[model samples]
Structure formats: C-alpha cells, structure tokens
Target: MATAKLKMSEVRGDVAVGVAQGGATVHALKLEGGKNVPLCPTRPKNGLRHMGLAHEQKPDLELCMKCSAIVPTGPVTVTKEQVSIPGLDRTVIRKVVRPVNDTDTTTEEEEAPVMAENTTTADPRDAQVEEIRASIERLPSLLEADNAEGAEELNGEIETAIAGLGGKGVAALRKTLRAERDKALAAGEEAKAAKTPSAEIVNLETKELDDNGKALIQKGIDKVKELAVNKFQGGHAIAEIVLDIRLGITTKNGYPDISADTDLGKKVGGALIFDDILAGLPEEGEDEASDAIRAEIGSIKKSARNAMQDVKVRYVRSLDNSPEEAKKFGYALEAHPDKKPSEAVFTFHGIQSLTRAEQAKQARELKAAEKEKTRLAIEAGELSEEEAEALSSDGEKSEKEKRTETSNKLKKTALKLISDVKGIEDEEEKDEALEALTVLFADLRKALTAK
Candidate 1:
C-alpha cells in the first residue's frame, strides 16, 4: 500500500495549484491556462480556494486526502509534535515525531539570485611583451659571461622579437654578437695605405706602351680633371676612369676580319657610360698600331685613376639622403651632427640655409618647452627634482637614435594594421580600409605631436 495525504502547491498569477475542488486532497501540480490536465484534472479555482483559505473555512481540510496518489514522490521532513501515543494511555499528551511534506511556498528566484560581473581581467599579451623585454635585458650579462651558446640563442630570440615588432634600423643591436664572432675571425681587408702599389710598378707597366700610349694616358688624366672640375668644382673623392679596347681574330669567312674596336667609358657614381667624352677615341685596326693604341688607352685609364686618388678634397654629407654626386668631389660623406638623419640636404664648407635656421629655431623652442614643463612639474609636486633631471638626461639621446625609435614604432603599428587589413578577402574593401587607417594614423600622429 502507498501513503495518501494532501499536497498543497503555491499559487502564482491567475493560476491555482494543488487544490482539488469538491475533494479534500490536492496534488502538487498546476493546470495550464485554467484547463484540465489529465495528470490532475481537479485543480483549485483561480486565486479563490487554496489550502490556507480552505482550512480557515473548514478545519477538517487538514485531514483531506484526495489528490495524494498522483503527487510527485520526494523527500519528506520529520518534526516532533504533541500528540496522543497509539496503544498507550488514552488522551496522553506525549511528544511524537511525525513525517511532514514540504509545505513552505517560496519561488526559485527567492532562493538564489544572479551575481554582478567582475571587472578585472589580465591581458596576456602585455605579459608576453614584458617577458621578451626581460630576455633582452639579460643580453649584456650573457655577453659578459662569455656564454657563446646562450648569447647565440638569445640573439635568435631577439631577432625574432624584432621581426615581430617590424624590424628596421636594429643593426646596432647585433654589435655584441658581431664582437663575439670577431674573436675567431680575422679581417680580410688590408689597410688602404698598405694596399697601394709602388710607383715603380706603374712606371714599368707604362714602359710597355709607346709615345702614343703615354699621350693617351695624359689625355685620359686631363679628361678626368676636366670632368671633375665641371661636375664637382675640383673635387675628386670618388670618381673613376674606365677604358675598353676590343679585337677580333682572322676573318676566314671573308667578313672584313674585324679587330681592335677602341672604346672608352666615363665612369661616374659607379656607373660606366660611353655617352661622355670617352665615347670614341682610338681608330679601329688589327695591326700593330691597334695593339699599341689599346696599350696606350690602358695606361691613360690607370694614370687617371691614380690622379683621382691624389686629388685630396674632404667633403661631408649634410644628411644621409644627400646626393651621391656630392661624394665624388671631395665632400664629406658623413651626415652633419646638427642635421636630422632623414633630412636630404647636402652642404659643403659649413654652409647653412634658411630652412636650417628655421629648424634650429624650432629645436630650441622644443627644448625650452620641455625644460619648462619639467620645471613646472617639479614645482607643482608632480615630480621630484631627481626624477625630472633623470628624464632630462634620458632626452639627451642623439637625434638619429630618437628618430630611429619613432620610425620603428610607426613601422610596428603600420605592420599590425597591414596584417589586419590583409585578412579582408575583398581587395577593394581592403584597399579602402587601409587608406582610411593611414589617414586616421596621420591625424592621430598630428594630434599627439602637437604642442
């Protein structure tokens, strides 16, 4: 046999549950939309007659046992209550334990509630960057220990990191590695002074040519000097003279058996051209005269080269991107200390242009503004004097170093944007998005760099 007892259900919103009408017992289930459900057709009236209200009308409702058979099986609670003991003294008021069904009506929302969102989340990329920087920081110690294997591994890692960061202008980072490599390798290039051939060798070589050969040599030297003055105003720091003479073998097939086509090249800026003064010189021939002319031309080219070496003029470039032709005329090939590495100006004899003056003025203004800002910070207690001075010292790095740093940062950001844009399958949309990003970056740079 199974137990039978009344099971009341909590009511909610226009639906009465676990209350059987015209019957004492009720099941713990509700009817959908006030309609009869086959599981429990005798549901309570809507918001009208439930267990508590029915008990107030009729005290005998507590003993109702109508819908208990279809009630869902679950755990029952036990509690002590004052009741008469069975088979003991009549009307004895003794405490007895009795099983109780769960009658407390509480919604699920009242038991547990949702929690608020947590705001703190750590970004892992920042940690990766820090780890890479820490590795780089260990390089000096590794080099000091002469740990070649460790240094090599670290070098590879740093190179990979630099590539990921848009590698450019990072050649200086490998100086330590190069120094270690240099320990086991000897330099191949001889000193420039030690490599010079003796003048006697030149004389001996020239002796093989006739008077015509000597004249050709003098002609070539004169031509080099003339071009030097015309191009570089008496500067011959990096000019070279080139000559060529060709000869053909006997024409057994009777096609004029060509030989000795004399030609010369005007060498400038590492390029040889026949369009200059050395276009056509010695007449073509196959006999002894042609051989003699060829020897003469060779002598002339050699003599011209020697003269260029002796032309002693020192010139320096105002910037890295200065004209190459300027170097040929004894100008300094090094960039000026005061000029930016990216500037394209070329200067000789310490010449200063109007643009340079403006640049100097702006540089001074920037320095003054930086100084004032530091001073204000210190006075306002935003920074200590020591910290301000330390920052000023840091700003004292060379302009080229600063420019290279800025360029590398820009390149890194641009590369990331390019990589993202490349993922777009539509070519036209990619191009458009890339252009918009470029313009946006330009605007952002302008805004950030503004005074």
Candidate 2:
C-alpha cells in the first residue's frame, strides 16, 4: 500500500509529490526516458488539494491519522503557545527583507526622468559618451597593432582626427600650401613644378591636359609637404600640429619652434613654450642673425604660423559647453597639458547630440550579422548575390524544406513563451511573448540571407 499526504492546491492541474517508506521518493517513473522533468499531476480527484514533496510528505514524519491540516509551505513562524517544550525559546526575527530599496525613489522634480528630446540639450558626459571617446581614441592603437591589414584601418582614424580639429589649424595649413604653390608659380613664369609625375599623391591619370598636351602632374611640393609629420609640407598644417602634440613636442602656442635656443631655454623653455608659441615666433628673429638663410628660415616659420592664424580670422568657435562644462574642460586640458584639445563649437545648449551607446553597438552588430549571413550564404550556395536585402516582417519565404523548418521553429518558440508563465495574467504574458518574438525575429532575419 502506498502512503502520501494530501496538501492544498489551486485547480484541476495539481502536483502530487511524496515518498513511500525507507526515505524513497517515487514520482512519475521513467517511461523510456531517464527522468520525469515535472511533478506528477495524477492525484486524488479533488479540485482544491494536492501533496507537496516537502515536510508534508516527509516519509518518516507522521501525523495523527484523523487530523486534517493546512500548513504554510513557504515560510515558517512559531507562536509563544507552541513553545511549551521546556526551555525552547520561540523568538523569531519577523522582518521581511526586501530585495530592492523602496525608499530610494527620487523625489526631485528637476531630476525627473528625461526623454530623448531633453537629453539632446544635456551634456555629453551625462549621456554614455565616455566609452565612445575611449573607443575612438583606442582605434589608432588597434590599427597600429593590426599593421598587416591590406588597407590599414588607422587611415580612417587618422583622417577623422585630422578632420575633428576644425579650427585655425586647417586654415593655416591651407595658406601654407597656397603660398608654396604661388612661390612654385613664381619660380617658373608658367612652368609648374614637374607636372603630374612630380607628385606622389597627385594622380597623373586624373590630370587635366594643358594646351601643350602635357599632363600637369605636379600638384606641387606643398602636397608632399603635408605628408611631413615630423615637420610638415602636407596640405594641412593643423594635422602637423596635432601630430607634433601627439609626439610629445613642446608646443608653446601652436607652431613648432624649430629655431635654435640655449640649453637653458630648451630645459626651462619647455615649461614656458605652450603659453606663447606664436607670440615667441615673430619676436625672436628681431634680435637674431640678419643673414639670408636666417631670413629664409624666418619667412618659412612666419608662413607656417600664418597658416593657423588664418583659420581664426574666419571662424571662431567657443570651446566649452555649459559654464560648468567649460570650467571642467579647461581644468582637464590644463591638467593634461600634453593632450590634444577638441575644437567643438560651444553651442549655448550642450554637446548638441543625443545617441545611446547601444545604437553604435547595434550598428556594429548589424554589420557583423550581415557579413556573417553573406559568408554563410556563400558556403551554402543558396544565393547568387553576396548582399542580402532588408526584409519585410511578412516576407514571401519560398522553399518547402525551409518553410517546414521555419514553421517548426516558430511553433517551438510559441510553446516556450506559453510555458514560461503557467496560467498567469494574459496581458503580462502577451507582452513578454511579444518582446521575445521581436528579439528572435531580428536575430533570425539577420542570419537568413535574401535567397
């Protein structure tokens, strides 16, 4: 004869779980499978009762044969009257421990939940921008590490860095190139510096033919000058300045002080340079040598300095965001004297951009997903084109085998969602199911190519 206790339950579906003698637990036994994953539902035909596998079903533990009982299975409490067993102290710590702090709720009206519209006008630091900046800065380092790439990834970051410093630096660079070009013109009444083959960066193939049928290959030495990072003839003088700063050169103002100075000046001057680089440039030659070489050097130095100053002449951008942001920014720049400063226009509002870090991550993931799908397609030979199209939610998915497989998958997914909540409120379960489906569909679509 089998023996088990009856415990309270909810409805037609009830779990009966208990042990017979000798501490043995007999449940829905192995049919052919090794285990019964859930509780046994077959029980006495009662709508409101079932036995639990806990103390209510403790094999050796006994209860009076005629007694009927209702016991709390989750938590236990003992009353003073139940402590009659000699000196058994029945004091219970009855404090309900909450997992989250209810009182930590914010009460400030100014600190109310912010929407994306309001977030745009706020400081970038308040948003998740630090990681973006960190990643952006790290890009150069990553490219340097991956030097074996066919098309170096560092080129884009270097370009972005050059583009980001949009200030007097760019203008200074433009003027230096133009001045050098004009000088090249003066060198020859019309003979340009060795026309197309004259320059590496200039593509002679794209060169417009002159009247003499010569391709103007020479874009000018100024083009090559921009390429000089240690110094520069590269078109952008600001890029040189940024590179110089990156290289740990003492930039007093902006121009590289190539002029010879005393050892004491070099040592003590590193301290004195940054505050007055441009101020020191023109003033230094006044008291120095009056020779031709010296004058040429002075002229070149002036030309370069003039490059950056020209940018300021046309456009002036305030560096700070809010007054507070400005103060903090100045402090950081001052503290990290060697680092490059961003030339973002201080729009009176704030950083003027609102974007979540997840958006960037999602974009990267989407690109990766597309590539993966293309690779899989190539391996499978199911699609002729390497690219996959953006699919509609309800796409005309053909192929009997694919449809059967996909339908089976959808049925399993719906079953899993339904099983996640047992007879709960339909509204909450539906919401959860919808959220799961959205994630599932995105992943499925990303993996399936246009075939």
Candidate that would win on TM-score = 2
TM-score of 2: 0.17
* Model 2 alpha-carbon miss at residue 401, Å: 9.3
Report lDDT (Cα) of residue 105, candidate 1.
71
lDDT scores of the candidates, listed in order: 0.40, 0.35
Candidate 1 lDDT by residue in tens digits, 1-451: 5344442321111111223322323333333343222233333342212222111223223222333444333332323334322212333222221122355576533422111101011212223345455666666555555565786787676555433321111233234334433442222112222445788776776437888988999999999999666544222322322211111222233211111122212223112432232344445564566556555554444444543422311112232445543333222334454644322223423333334345568888888998899889998999997677667833675565678899899899889878999899744345446656767778888999999
For candidate 1, what is the TM-score? 0.15
Model 1 — which ten-residue stretch has the worst lDDT?
112-121
